[model samples]
Target: MRLLLIEDSAELAKWLAKALQGSGYAVDMAHDGQDADHLLFTQTYDAVILDLELPSMDGLTVLRRLRARGSTVPVMVLTARGELSDRVAGLNLGADDYLAKPFELSELEARLHALIRRAHGVSAPLITLGPLSYESVGRTFTLGGATLALRPKEHAVLEVLLLRGGKAISKEKLFEKVFSVDATTGQDVVEIYIHRLRKQLHNSGVSIITLRGLGYLLEAT
Candidate 1:
């Protein structure tokens, strides 16, 4: 999944971003609240990790703006403020979860997984679509009870498609989620991954359909 992390601490942000990427998530960083707010309106992210203290805008103000705009993207507040009042304010302002500073990476990841699952209306880690089953936390895909091996990019592509099944996702949107914004690769690379996935799942009961002018969709055979 794709996540936006709004953190002003340079060292902390870099460390978290790298850890998130290693865990199979495409992450974007914003050092200031204003930039994070702008990106929230312009781009789509599965969830957001926000810190309260910011340069251009405070995290609470950003959160308020986000809710005022009627955006329900899951948000997890991560900050050094561990006070009960701070946590309550964040939750009241539409934050999905809260994580204190000096927290374990494992706990942060677990909270993110919970947020994603709740957002998707999935209470269980194993997400099933037809004969395909995906373990969200493990980042493993199983088809017909057998493991399905895929390259990292290919796996990322399939994960997004499956999460948004039935909707036709534009190639540009897919590229944003699968590849970094600064990636040197061309958009055509998305098609290449799609082609490979189609071939890989040929005998499976799943199908990836191109929508011509639209983009691609995942459907059951």
Candidate 2:
């Protein structure tokens, strides 16, 4: 999954970004609300981890603007304030989840996974189709009693496809979920990665079909 992190604290932002990246997510960092707004408005993100205290525009303004623009992307508020009123205010502002500072990274990761899955309409942690099983935590793809390690982006893209069970996913959406920044260097870039993944899956005798004008899908037969 790809996520945008809007936080002002340099040290905490760095730590959170590194930890999130380690957990198989592509993360884009914004130190203030303006950059975060630019990213949120222009690019695609599966979920956003927004800090309530920001330098320029404040995270609440960013959240309000995003929600006002009819963007339904999931957002989780990360704040130092643990007061009940703060939490309630964040929820009222459309935050899907809230996390107080000094919390464990593992819990944040779990919340991130939950928000992403919920936004995508998946109620379960495990995603499987046909003979294939996807381990989200391990970032492993299993087929026919064998497991293959996938690069983070490859794993993210494939997870979306497999979750849909052979349904075509648009290339734009693929780029959104796979890359945290710069989704459109060119459509051909997406094609390149998709081609590599297709070859790899086919070699394993798992079919990955491209629906020419639409996008790519996994159809193992």
Candidate 3:
């Protein structure tokens, strides 16, 4: 998943970025509301972590503006406000969840997981397709009753294909899900990764078929 973190505190932002990255997420950071707003306009993120006490544009203003413009990306507000009124106001302005200062980093992480799950209509973490299985939170893939260790991008790309199992996925659509805009990757990179994955699948008699001018589809024998 790609997450946008809007925080002015460099220390906290860096720590959170590292934690999320370790958990198999792509993270982008913004120091203030202006920068955050600009990024929101430019790229798409699965979720947003907005700190209410931000400079230039307060988190509330940013939240309200984003909603007003009809962007429905999930957002969890992280701020020093823990009072009932503040929390109520944030919800009224379309904030999906809230986290207060001095909070356990675990709680913030959990809330984020919940937000993304709800957005994607997923209440569970396991994804199964024919003889293949995937555990989203664990970042593990099981193919043909054997465990496979895959790079993060490879895992993400395979998961997308497996989710669509019977449907053909265009390379453009796959790119949108696996690579964040800031990634220093070219369009052909997807082809390379899929090429590698195809070989691995072929070794086990599972097939990820390339559709010539189209993209790919997974077929299990």
Candidate 4:
């Protein structure tokens, strides 16, 4: 999934972005609230990690404006402000989750996964379709009880398909979710990954089907 990380701390942002990318997420970073807000206005993300302290605009204001615009994208507040009032204010402003600073990366990742899953209406950590099973915690896929090895991009494409299984997803939308805004790759790269995934899923009682103009959907055969 793609995430917009709105943080003012350059060092922390760098560290967080790197860690998130390593965990199979495509991350876009904004060091200030103004830039972050602009990105939010123009782009779509599976979720956002926002810091309350920001330049030009506070995180709450950005969040309020986002909600006012009727966007339901999930937001997780990650800030040093851990007071009860602060938490209440963020929740009231539409933040979906909250994590204080000096926190463990593992906890942050776990919370992020939960938030995304809930947003997609998936309550369990394991997502299964036919012989294909995906363990969201470890970000691993298995077929017929055996590990299905995949390259990073291939894994990313499969994740999106599995998360929205049975629903047709446009190639453009898949590309957006699988690649960061800064990536120089063309949209056709999505086809490459899709092709790879098709080969990997061959004869597994599951298939990735293309619908001429509609896009692609994963289904059990």
Candidate 5:
């Protein structure tokens, strides 16, 4: 999935961005609230990780303005402030989850998975279609009770399709979610990954259908 990470700490932002990318997410980083706000206005993301302390505009203001504009993107507040009031403020301001600094990366990833799932209106960690199953925590796919091995980009493409199962997703949207904003690769790379995933999922009781102008759809056969 694509995620926006709004943080002021350069070192922490770099570290977290590397970690999140390693975990298979296409992440965009904004070191301050204003930059983050600008990106939020211009781009689309599956979720956001926001820090309460920020340069220029505060994180709460960013959240407030984001909501004021009727954007329902899932947001999780990650900050050093652990006070009850801070938590309440962020939650009230529309943050879906809160994690204080000195946190575990695993916990943060888990929370992100939960937030994305909820945003997609899915409640379970395991999503299944026919004999294919996806486990969100491990980010693994299984077919016919056996593990389905996939390259990183292939896994990313399939995951997005599975998350939005039965719905048509444009090639442009898949490109955005599978590649970071700074990626040097062209949009045609999405077709390559989609082609690879099709081979991997062949005869798995599900298929990725190309819809001409409408893009791709994952559906049970």
Candidate 6:
């Protein structure tokens, strides 16, 4: 999934971004509230990790503006303040989850997974369709009770598809999520990956369908 991380502390932002990337999420970082606000308004992110202390604009203001604009993107507040009032204020301002500083990375990731799944209307960690099953926390995809082997990009592509739950995803969005900032390839790479995934998933009760102008959709046959 694509995530926007809004943090002002350089060292902590770097650590969090690295940990999140290692967990298979496509991450975009904003070091201040203005940039974070702009990115949240203009771009699409599956979820956001927001720090209450920020430069230029406070995180609560950003959150209020975001919700005021009718955006339902999941948000998790990260702050050093563990006070009850602060937590209640954040929740009232529309944060999906709250995490105090000095927390474990695993707990943060688990909270993010639960928040995103709830936003997507998925109530379980395991996603199943036909012979395929996906474990969110472990990041594993299996078919017919066996693990499915996939390259990194292939795994990313399939994960995005499954998260959308059969909805069509634009090729541009897929490229943005699946390819890295340093990737040298163009958007045409999405077509190649789709073709490869189709071949790999053949006869596995899952199929990748091209929707012409709409993009690609993954469905169970």
Against the true structure, what is each candidate's TM-score?
0.91, 0.88, 0.83, 0.96, 0.97, 0.91
lDDT of 5 by residue, 62-111 (tens): 99999999999999999999999999999998889999989999999998
Question: Which lDDT tens digits does candidate 2 get at residues 92-148?
Answer: 989999999889987888788778777877776667766677765444788766786
lDDT of 1 by residue, 96-197 (tens): 999999999988998898888788777778888899999987779999999999877788899889878468899999988877655688999989999999
The C-alpha lDDT values of all candidates are 0.90, 0.81, 0.81, 0.92, 0.91, 0.88
Instruction: Please provide the root mean square deviation of candidate 6 (C-alpha atoms, Å).
Output: 1.9
Worst 10 residues of 1 by lDDT: 175-184
Question: For model 4, how does the per-residue alpha-carbon lDDT over 1-221 read when each residue is reduced to its tens digit?
Answer: 99999999999999999998888789999988889989999999999999999999999999999999999999999999989999999999999999999999999999998888888889888999999999888778999999999887788788898899588999999999989999999999998888888898888899999999989999999
Model 3: per-residue lDDT, tens digit, 91-197?
99999998889888767777787787667666678866666777655557898778977777777678667656478888877776677667788778889889879
| Candidate 1 error regions (>4 Å) | none
Let me know the TM-score candidate 5 reaches against the reference structure: 0.97
- Where does candidate 4 clash, by residue pair? none
Model 1 alpha-carbon miss at residue 92, Å? 0.8
| Model 2 pairs in collision | none
Between candidates 3 and 6, which one is better according to lDDT? 6
List the candidate 6 regions with Cα displacement exceeding 4 Å. Answer: 179-185
lDDT ranking from best candidate downward: 4, 5, 1, 6, 3, 2
lDDT of 6 by residue, 1-221 (tens): 78888999989888988888777777888999999899888888888999999999999999999999999999999999899999999999999999999899989998998888888888888998888899987778999999988876788789889989879999999988766544588999989989998998999899998898999999899
Name the better of 1 and 5 by TM-score.
5
lDDT of 4: 0.92
* C-alpha lDDT of residue 167 in model 4: 88
